[model samples]
Target: MASVTLTLLPGPDLLFVITQSVSQGKRDGIAVSLGLCSGLIVHTFAAAVGISALLYHSAVAFQLLKYAGAAYLLYLAWMSLKETGRSGLSATEPKRSFFSLYKRGILMNVLNPKVSIFFLAFLPQFISPAVGKIPLQMITLGGLFFVQALLIFSLVSVFSGMAGEKLLKKSMGSKSISYVKAAVYALLGVRLALLEK
Candidate 1:
């Protein structure tokens, strides 16, 4: 059999995750980020285990996933364009239950497609299949990313949400926050669009 190669992936891109959490209200921000991070942990394991692994090896599967991710990113872009502080900063709180939040996190990461493929491409860089410990390495790397992601997203949530809440109370501050968020989301969406599998 021809030799197969493996390596460590670059891990998760925390920028977008941090940006997303920063827009939410403070008290609930960290909770939501942690919620998302929790989902990421599972995704890392899933990728390390099988589903994402196979998908990465299959060109057809990877393409399919890439398109799907691009579409989702576009949808997010549209949402960001339509959403301004006027509506997002309203007095009402999110009606989503904890279960819903958890589910949302799972679905968000799982459906992104880019994330899974990224793991497939990235994780192998640090792996040494020839050393007879690929799985162990994958798990360790995934865990590292989980911790980093959790830390970054948590800080984003706490600071952004809390500061945003204070700013949201002021019309100028609310507008400023919304503008930044809108730009970030739109920019990320555009970047995702340009990504190749």
Candidate 2:
């Protein structure tokens, strides 16, 4: 519950989902949410198996992942800005394919070393050695987090999509949406870049 609440907070993941929802519509937003959750599933498994610990302790690996995540975000920002005029942000549909949105969601989450480190630190606190198996317990708890995240993210998708539809229908600030999203992506990239191992 605590994890879910924290996830619900307006962090990068939530922000990204909202941006996707506002631009792409409900279906694409849901797909992107699924991709993000899938990345969390990977993190959960890695935490249980100790791969997350490796990322947590290894400064080199951590730095590499952080920069990679930042670079990816910057790339996204560039692409968004480059396609600004043609994106039809005011249209009812997204210019990009569903698969592309899904893949972007996965890449965005997977490349963030902070998430892996968070799993390593957060999951273990809930797990007990007295349990039959630490790995199993970690996985179970992580699964709970994934479910909560999915539900919350989906809700965000629906609401944001509706909001987007209204904005598009009004044809108000359509061009601004693209520019705002680009700024957001660029800012997130800078945030990731400033993170320490």
Candidate 3:
């Protein structure tokens, strides 16, 4: 139940997947979600082994990662604006390969230190000394969480993709959607920038 709640909550990861679904299509959104969840696997492993603790405690590492995530968001915003110009009057937003979207999702999630911190802090709650091997328990729990996230994200992608398809059918609507996508990306970047390390 907690996993479902957390996955459904409004957060950067959810927002990004929604934007991708609305701007591109369902496939890209699912691909990106898979990539993002893959990053969570890394975080799970790191948390299990205590590497996430090292990141959590080190100021320099946290700040560097925070800035990098912010910069990437800004870059994505810029890319959206550029696509907006080129997509003028087009029926589709733009074309980007599935692999590219997947890679971007992985990089974006991996660079966000908050995720690592969340795993470090949250996963321990479900673990008990009675579980015997702690690392194995963490991995199992994290995988369960990821599965829930995948389902929620997939639902979001489907609905958003339907909306995007309908909106992009008209020339004016396509332009409007493009501008909205750019605005959302810019806002996400600003939000990331304002986060304190």
Candidate 4:
């Protein structure tokens, strides 16, 4: 329940997925979601292995990662803004490969140091020394979290895609979509830039 709630909460991941669905298509959104969840695998392992602890304790490492994430998001925002200058038709836009979207999602999620710290803090509450093995238990919990997150993100993609298609048919131009996407990315970038350890 907690995992589902967390997944459903408004965050960079959810915003990115929604924007992709609204602007591109459902499949692209799902590809991004998959990539984001793949990043969770890394975070889960890092938490279980105490690497997250190291990051948390190292201010320079944390700051470097945070800034990198912020910069990347800003770059994405700039790219979206640049798209606004193109022909105002969606049909003229070049299709992005699934791999590109997936890679973007992975980079977006992986660059956020807070996620690893979150996993480091959140995963241990359910753990027990009485368990067969601590790391195994953490992995199990992480897997559950990953599955739930993927389902929720995919659902968001589908619904958003449907709405976006309708909106496009109703005369929402590609330029408008580009503006919205740019706004989302910019806001996410600013939020990430202001994030603290």
Q: What is the TM-score of each candidate against the true structure?
A: 0.69, 0.93, 0.93, 0.95
**TM-score of candidate 1 on Cα atoms, chains taken together:** 0.69
Q: Best candidate, TM-score-wise?
A: 4
Residue 102 CA error for candidate 4 (Å)? 0.5
Q: Largest lDDT belongs to which candidate?
A: 4
Better of 1 and 3 by lDDT: 3
The residue pairs in collision within model 4 are: none
Each model's C-alpha lDDT? Answer: 0.60, 0.85, 0.84, 0.90
Residue-level lDDT of model 3, residues 14-96, one tens digit each, is 98998888777888889889888888898999999999999989988888988898899888888777776554334553566
Off by over 4 Å in 3: 88-94
TM-score (C-alpha) between model 2 and the true structure: 0.93
The root-mean-square deviation over C-alpha atoms between each candidate and the true structure, in angstroms, is 6.2, 1.8, 1.9, 1.4
Tens-place lDDT per residue, model 4, 1-197, is: 98998999999999999998887778888999999998999899999999999999999999999999999999999999998765333677788889999999999999999999999999999999886799999999999999999999999999988877766664546678889999999999999889998
Ranking by lDDT: 4, 2, 3, 1
lDDT per residue as tens, model 1, 30-101: 555566667666667767788887876677776765666556555655665555645455656344465665
After superposing candidate 1, which stretches have Cα over 4 Å from the reference?
Answer: 1-13, 85-87, 93-98, 121-133
Backbone clash tally (model 3): 0
Task: Give residue 31's error in model 2 in angstroms.
Answer: 1.0
Summarize candidate 2's per-residue lDDT along 1-197 as a digit string, tens digits: 78977898888899999987886678878988988988898899998998988998899999999999999999988877865665445354346687787888889999999999888888888877977799999889989998999899999999998987776665444566678778999999999999986
